[model samples]
Target: MTSAPDMTGRTLLQVIPKLKGGGAERTTLEVGAAFVRAGGTSLVVSSGGGMVEELEQGGSEHIAMPVESKNPLLLAQNARDLADLVKERGVNIIHARSRAPAWSAFFAARRTGTPFVTTYHGTYGAKTAIKRRYNSVMVRGDAVIANSAFTAQHVRKQYEGLPYFDGSRMVTIPRGADLERFDPASVGEERIRPFSLRFGEGFKVVMPGRFTGWKGQGVLIEAARLFREERPDVPLRVLMAGRMDEKPDYVDGLRRRIAEAGLQGVVELMPATDDVPALLAASDVVVSASTDPEAFGRVAIEASAMGKPVIATAHGGSLETVLDGETGYLVPPGDAEALAKALGKLHALGAEGRRAMGERGTQHAGQKFTIEAMTTSTLLVYERLLGQKG
Candidate 1:
């Protein structure tokens, strides 16, 4: 949206837990590439995953490390090792994404006397003193980036009256969707065909996220059953697709819920896929049903970007992203009846009304949220810190 501050001859190191398919990981890659494009040397340190190739392709170097480990011993060791790296690489500014890596980066930057920046990527639970202390590393930087305004508020409130509270340092930059990848026109028929063949001709709804309890996968299951009861004629099929590797017990519990609710035919737990855009393309309405308020819900934004009408719970960033009765509907969080009603409303709108809503969403997402826009805003944060260093 604005001219990116030049990164000429600067070396920026971004530390994250992993290069996985999450908003934090995506933002790390986006900013890393932007830094490189603006003439900076970009280095990403993480437990490498599927996105490593793409990061390399963007002219950034991948330094594989166990930064994702939450073990205290490894964290201390990582700090010492990273401190050495900062000195050897002559790192201009080091930024961190997750808490564990932020702790490592914090000590590393302090040890090397390097400028440290951190992004508050999630609204982590801090019910106890120890957990609050553990989460504090994210705010221990010269500059702290909050992925959304909602998150910025959380940071201010969480650390308020505490020693590290500095409201001035917190910056709100909303996460952006990659418009080019999410473009409906760019999505080919072949990409949507397989999904269509597999899950054909129902009111296809896809909730793309992990099988986490808070993500509201179980909520969606209940909503699906209710919708099926309300409208027996309409085949309501939902695909809860995301990283299904962790939390086997939670997964099993959800499977039981689906079975008990008789949502076996209505809902499917699809495994994570790299082609999220293709999955979005195949669905009619995208759902983001986080039982708790998300700091910023990228699902709603990305779904809107793909010219798809969305149905997300009403709270947090979804309030900002989804315009009620315009781009999509926002039912109350954890309210299965409300969610079911919203689902029925979208289907009742028919193809043309849904398409119109989707078209408006595409325009909204393109204007308000795109990777270029997010990248530029984040680079400015780096530039501001680098300029201070100068």
Candidate 2:
């Protein structure tokens, strides 16, 4: 097979904490693959994870490093190593996806006289001066790319006195969902049957978030309990599909709660999988029950793009994505009663009403949330940066 085009003439290095499965990681992979597709070189430096294989398959180079460490000594080492890579590879630019790596990439790009770009994916709760300082690298890039309009506002509000953000170096290129992977047409009815099988032909209500308490999996379980109590004949099932990441005890607790509430037969817990499009397609109503503000509810966007109605908590990007009572419903965060009420209304929506809502969701997704739109807007920002560099 032909290798990814040599990027020697136009090399870019992407620095992140690790090649993990998050929005920033996914975006990094996408940009790297896109760069390779466009006959440019893309190199990623990180403490490698599952995405390493995908990066190599996509014809990009991977350099394993302890880039995620917060210790000052490790960061200094990263800076030196990154600068060496930048100089040796003739990297034209350095894009950092997290703060720790941004700290190293920033200085490396500077030492090599290469452009430095950063994406402010979300806000991290700062508890101390050092914490704030650690977060500053995210804004210090030559061009700071904010992933959402809300994040752009936060960046400005936080760095009010910073000069670059005076509308010149700051640009908002919203994150996007992979429509090709998430499209309803891509998943057939037969493939969707297993998800329904778990619920025994019930109206499948699914909450697709990591199995953490903050993700409100417990609240969703409670909501399912309420739904079953009220409508025993509706044949309802709640599927919690996500990796019990960083919190196995919480997952166990959810199981205990499920049993305590006598929902063992009504609720199913599934691990994270790549079959999100199929899950969304099979779902009667998709839920995003993050008790906290999600930087952005990608699941909501993907579900909407697939013409599925979503019920997300009314916080963070969900407010911007879900049109309350129009495309989908939004309830108060962490309120299972309100969640149950919203799901009740969604279930009450017959085939025609649900179809109409799904249509509206798809229209919104097509207009605002596709990968092409996101990529095109980002390219505009890059062109502006390159032009200014020239």
Candidate 3:
């Protein structure tokens, strides 16, 4: 493992649209905490949300700004404000985690002669030249960080012909799960009791992510119907747990589908919860049935860290995170029948076999995706960019 560098007396600034519950927001907090741990001054700029208090608790300072606005004048003004902040705070490096804020941060860094870094957290849509140009700011960093190898490949392919684009600058740093929190041993019956009451007696299958069509909640519902038909004697329950406010129509559609399939009692849609580790611990099997590719599958890693078998779509980052038939199973993306088959295989494993799979998954997660490894790698990138040593 690489040692973290001496970041004492240096200041690092991270910019994101908001302090939300997305992967990028979580990474921002993790990196900020890492910076403070190394004795460096850590600062974050965002529109502000639920995570502000948590970020501050990690010994990082937060500046509230309207970085989420896409208005051209607002963005340009933000750039000027950021440049002032950079100079005033003696910020050594500026890191951007979202597209809108990246544009502003890129200009600010150039204006202040500070090293700039960016983490491409998504496979951004580039349907037109204008869209591609807008997305280009994410790759303009001195060191471009990608959440996964799959994301790095997407970046290279998307900007293949740009004369100034250097693919070699892109680095893959897989997102990590908090092993201390997600450990099965840490989540006891007391924590799992509430969910167990709701789940009742049966094998619990959990699909957790924000409610969206691409998340494949409908696909999972169809698969649940199939699973019930094939094994009438076996008891099973499916929970679609996530926030539904973003797409109320989609949530309504899912409810209709669940009712049409006669899975009203068997399948339930629940709101997102803060206690994800406990939920996964209570689950018999966790699923990530996305119709589209994920930049990196954090849910899969989190579930694996909790020592639970995950059934994820066989595309995107899941291909990199999950070891098929070992830690968990990977079914064809969007294939309801294939998902049903995979669920059946896990059900047949029974308690002992499933427990063994979970153990392997836990070990794999510790070796490859712990938060310590991720923070160390990311700090190394900052150290290299600034020509600093431990």
RMSD of each: 1.4, 3.4, 1.3
Clashing pairs in 3: none
Q: Could you tell which candidate, 2 or 3, scores higher by TM-score? A: 3
Give the clashing residue pairs of candidate 2, or none.
7-41
Off by over 4 Å in 3: 388-390
User: What digit string (tens of lDDT, one per residue) describes model 1 on residues 1-390?
Assistant: 488888898999999988867788888888988899999999999999989999999888999889999999999999998998898888989999989999999999998878899887889889999999999988888998888888888888889888886778888888889888888789899988988765777899999987899999888898898899999999878888877778888988989999999888778887887788889999999999998988889889889988899999888888889999999999998999999999999999998999999999998998888888888988888888777877
- lDDT string, candidate 2, 1-390, tens digits: 122333335777889999878888888887777677656788999999999999888778999999999888988889999998887887877889899888988888888778888998776776786777778888877888888777777777776775534546788777788888877878898877776666567687888877777888888888988888888888777888887767888888989999999988788898887777877787788999998887767888888888889899998888888999889999999898999888889889976788789889988887888776665565455555556777
Relative to the true structure, how large is the alpha-carbon lDDT of every model?
A: 0.89, 0.81, 0.93
lDDT of 1: 0.89
List the candidates' TM-scores in order.
Answer: 0.97, 0.93, 0.98
Q: Is candidate 1 or 3 superior in TM-score? A: 3
The candidate 1 region of ten consecutive residues with least summed lDDT is 193-202
The numbered model that scores best in TM-score is 3
Clash counts per candidate, in order, are 0, 1, 0
Candidate 3 matches the true fold with a TM-score of: 0.98
lDDT of 3 by residue, 1-390 (tens): 777888999999999999978899999999999999998999999999999999999999999999999999999999999999999999999999999999999999999989999998889999998999999999989899999999999999998779868887789999999999898888889999999888889989998999998999999999999999999888889988999898999999999999999999899999999999988888999999999999998999999998899999999999988999999999999999999999999999998999999999999999999888998999999999898422
**Residue 19 error, candidate 1, Å:** 1.6
